[model samples]
Target: MTDIEARFWSKVDKSGDCWLWTAATTYGYGRFAITKRQMIGAHRFAWETVNGPVPDGMVIDHLCRIRLCVNPAHMEVVTNGENVLRGEGLSALNARKTHCKNGHEFTPENTIVTKNPSGNGRACRECRRAAWTARATCPECGGSFSARNLARHRTNQHGGSHV
Candidate 1:
């Protein structure tokens, strides 16, 4: 075996289904030095060593969910977005929601997708309209107005004091 391969295998504990790396790690992922100034994920190295280069626009995902696992059998290549969706992060959790917090089903008609600096987010149209309606009722005059009209109503009718 080559020097690098031997060095890599020497650090792995293969007693179980997931081959765990027993070396340096960062953020729960095993790290390996491939060159004097370069490091790579140990799992990635293990995968490439056995299966070949990861496909373009694809990343390695650990099916075993163990970041330190270097077993190529426990990994799969997938798109970055697919990887995130399969994870347990906020984005994945939010994407898995079939209904809003107010028990409104996320039907196409009841859902409003909003684009922001972070990313696209889903909002319930009924909940949003309800919130707007609640704010649209003028407290001073007890008058009902549209959301846009409420500010003008408060200004013109209430002399801008309530606004």
Candidate 2:
């Protein structure tokens, strides 16, 4: 083993299925300082030590769901979306929700999905239309409509020509 690997292994408490990091940590996961000015997640450091560089746009997930685990055997590489889905935490629970919090069924017609800071999440299309209807006013026609309706309204009023 190399010197870096030795230092990393020294901090591991391998008495359990999940090899726990027994060193300084932030947010339950371990933190390793490579130099006076550099730091990286200990779990990540441990992974690269044995496997290799994690591919860009991919994240390493703790299959065991133990944030402190550094065992490469318990890790898997996946996209951010996949990682969130596989998690057993709050995000996973929310992602699995069949309806929005306000009881709107997340059908294809009523669900708006987009990337959020924490990967991807769905919004209620009905709520979006409602909000737009309540707040948006067309500048061209001084007409009241949701943004979606306003698009059609403009098209109908303007003889179906691009505005």
The candidate that achieves the highest TM-score relative to the unseen native structure:
1
lDDT of 2 by residue, 23-110 (tens): 9999888998887688989999989988999999999999899999999999998999899778777888887899887899999999
Query: Which segments of model 2 are wrong by more than 4 Å?
Result: 88-91, 99-105, 109-163
lDDT of 1 by residue, 1-163 (tens): 7899999999999999899999999999999998879899999999999999998999999998999999999999999999999999999999999999999999999999999999999999999898777646788879888776788888887784555
Candidate 2 least-lDDT 10 residues? 154-163
Q: What is the TM-score of each candidate against the true structure?
A: 0.87, 0.62
Clash pairs for candidate 2: none
Name the runs in model 1 displaced over 4 angstroms. Answer: 133-137, 146-152, 159-163
Residue 24 error, candidate 2, Å: 0.7
